[model samples]
Target: MATMSSICAPMISVLPRRPMIVAAFQQYCSRRTFRRTLQVRSCSSATSHVAPLRRLANYHPNIWTDEHVQSLTSTSKVQREEERERINVLKEQTRNLIREKQQVAEQLQLIDHLQQLGVAYHFKDEIADVLSRLHASLDHVRWELKDDLHATALLFRLLRAKGFSVSQDLFETFRDEKGNFEARCENPIRGLLSLYEASYYEKEGESVLKEAMDFATEQLKALMEEGSVPEAGGLREQVAHALQIPLNWRLERVHHRWFIEACSGDNTIDPLLLEFAKHDFNLVQDMYKSELKELSKWWSELGLSEKLPFFRDRLFENYLWAVGFTYEPDNWRCRLNETKAICFITLIDDIYDVYGTLDELQIFTDVVNRWDLTAMDKLPEYMRLCFFALFNFVHDEGYRVMKEKGLDIVPDLKRTWGDLWTADFEEAKWFHHDQTPKLEEYLENAWVSISGPTILVNAYCMGKDLTGEALKSFPSYYQITRFSSRLFRLIDDMGTSTDELERGDVAKCIQCYMHEKGVSEEVARSEIRELIKKHWRALNASLSWDSPFQEYFKNIVVNVPRTAYFFYQDGDGYGKPDGETKSQIISIVFEPIQI
Candidate 1:
């Protein structure tokens, strides 16, 4: 929304408000609770059995059935060769969509469309060439800054999203002498939408971009509710969608499929681009189907859902999480590997949190920490199958990572698993003892319990060259991953805490805040939301670290949290995908655009 052109000696003078208290409060909590918490934690480490475990039915049985597995495994879906050839032709046509001499605004809009279509990866060089030239000669660009709010905002959002250092000065052109945005203009609603999208890339301390967000959100929300125009209904839908998830937060494939439908019936949209988008989308869907065929077959063979009735059967959701981790076709192995890893994490988490009793949990934890099948005798009959499943999976993964990749990250991977178990065990201990930790105290361990770092370690190992240096140099990656884990914990707490509390879990961050500050649920939730944003900035800042690995490698870590936010933003979208997330999964992975 904002761009740089010239300096504003005293540009919009910003009124300074009270500094945010959340960050300060978090630091204060951490400091104040440090010594006492350690003392409490020391006592907590010594276990004392209090009461017999209740047969808790806190969660419902998983909806999956053997028949469901049978049907998924039996399905033989394949895209015909004819479709591949057709898509190749359409890709060529789409390539022609980005030519050398297009107007700068048009080029930016085209790039934006291609990106949202999930086919931008196919045209990276073409898009990059256009943006590079445009960036080098912005002054000589053909588009005038005065008349085109939509184009300006779109260009700003796209370029800034691509890591360009565009400034906020150009946005000032839309403001009056009193430094207020002009809300009345041609296509003001669409302009405001793009401006809102652009504001997400605001770096820390950029008050202008922050102000732009408040301005655009205020304008868009008012416009949506007022029903001011003949096409107010369409405007309402567009506004609602934009305000619900900022463009940066959206998964590319998910947004792409949605856009394919949104652009339908719009005469101005390029026919070639639209056709190519459909072809590419379904083509990728075919790839996902093919991959899932193998994964589903493997999952069906495990018979996990039938054996471990308590564990949620989410074969599809696990794979979907991997897709979020890395969606490029060449990264299928990483996706598959990460999918299996997360599957175990999810099930094991369920075991510690819900199903397994205190004695059973300690035995299983020790068995897992040792990765020893000999200890399986100590587990309950049901847990033996679960333990063996993970044992065999880890051994197989270890062999692949070592023999296939010629690097021994097995130990590191197991260490991540160890960290996860320690965290999970700690929480299980607190839960069993009916302990309510201080906000800082719970957060210290809860982030790990979220298991993002463990899942991401598998992702990193799968996707990267497993060098000795890379294996040992994991702390930096783990640091970035901690940010993700914290976000996932916060989001999970936001979505599932009430149910969790009812089921006799330890106090989540929100509950701890409510207890500590004596605040209402609403206020506690608002504070948690602010804290989530704080970690979001931390995640963004982590990407700027001097990493031994490439930026893409780091991005996979960052995307861990991005995908979590996408998954858990509204509710426990991953665990309960009945509403927005369900539709999104259908659009991205199953339904094809009707070309």
Candidate 2:
């Protein structure tokens, strides 16, 4: 042992290089004997006059020269130092590899677990659980590793790709760590579905999508405890209680599809019909103010003086009726206008053609013609609505076409017309009968043709003029009207027989009409088809009348097939529906008319 604190400590000390040599000398031989016995030791001792070995038998040198000792000491220190350094390097390398392997293993485990979960993780319930687990893990990591970015993001991708269950706030709070989010979303199945789903939600997931949803029940509970969340106050329950709405496939699908089809084709239904339907269907909530303003401006610019006088009031009434007819049932304007139009049309049609004598008609006509709107004070209350409608609608461009068709060719035609119009109530009623044997039957048949493919054209105009909540889509209207018309026509046509019609059957006119159209005898009725084509042309022209109902009317005429009119049953005198007929009609016709 050595005390190196000594100031006089030897600068260099040498010891035997070999452990075996040093041990052998110490155990076996004395230094004097060893020196005398060894040839080199003997020679060196003689020359140096080797100090007489003290106690030769037990002689032991305090100082000795041995190259091995010095070499051994130097090698031992160097070897120990090298060994220490190697052990340290190995431990450091192993620790680093362990960390790397742990990360890879964790990711693999996650992937395998997710694969087992399958795509169900992308939906709601399962997705929420996955997100909860993921968020919990993150929370642990945030505490354990102080929010490692690479670690957190991989978990985020897993959660997002599978489905989101976390609040947008939580997701956004970690967005800085989500470097290149779009680039990370490379999974094809995940990408397609995610994009489609995102289209229904907000573009920026930060506020609504990610932050809005709670990641965990605990998190939700926390918010409630803090009073940060608002109460819904049973609003949804109230809404459900107030309404028992049913689904209408016709309104939702068939009518919309058919309307678009008709509008796209080379038919009289105005092309704008589909546009109108779309506006009412989708944009009504947002675009109401602008639409009303434009409609009013158009009305003010066009006055009643430009329209044909005879059909002028009728056109105006129709316009007002349109405004009322196309809005939701709860709308005040709609209700008001509906009441006014219904009474006005019912009374005016009767007064003009059926209800009044020629003298009365003349006086009424003179009253409307000679005076301004103020003079309507002398007429019945219903007349006021009629006069206003006429005054306003005549100002529309629709009447110009009828005038140009040489309809007003005769001079002093009113004077001649008053005489001609005298006492024709019976004839007019007969003409009405000639047109349709029964009122219900007539309305049903007309409604079918009007609603089917025809609504698309008319929807455009209706959408343009109406305001407030969208009552019903043009497509829905067409569907309802078509189904109604077809159901009635089918029952009416099938009930009648050719034999019955030949027997001077005035009762089952539906059958008579079918026979007149030669529907039964001929497999493919060419003449009937030609008549339909002509009717369609007329209907198209009628729809183009440039009135407010122009678009609505156009669709009615265009979408409905003429053949559908023949669907009614034909009976000898009058027809009745079969037992199953009502149910079948209700199922097919009425089921699809919901909003």
Clash total of candidate 1: 2
What TM-score does model 2 achieve against the real structure?
Answer: 0.23
lDDT of 2 by residue, 399-433 (tens): 43234332221212122222222222322332323
Best candidate, lDDT: 1
Q: Write the per-residue lDDT of candidate 1 for residues 1-595, one digit (tens) a residue.
A: 0110011011222123223356533443343354235335444553553433333434544444445534432113354476778888988877876875377667777888788767787876787678767767765552465566777787777666555556776577777898888744467777788788887766666677778989999887777678652353345555687889887666656667777777665554677788878877777777787777778788878888777777667777777778877777777888888888888898888888776666677887778778888878897788899878877887788898778768876776776787777678777776655455667777777877888767777777776555677666666565667777788788788987766655545568986776567666779999999888778656655555333344446657756766776777776776676667667666666666677
**Cα deviation of 260 in candidate 1 (Å)?**
0.6
Query: What overall lDDT, based on C-alpha atoms, would model 2 receive against the true structure?
Result: 0.31
Off by over 4 Å in 1: 1-54, 64-79, 132-147, 164-170, 183-186, 229-236, 464-474, 544-551, 578-584
Best model per TM-score: 1
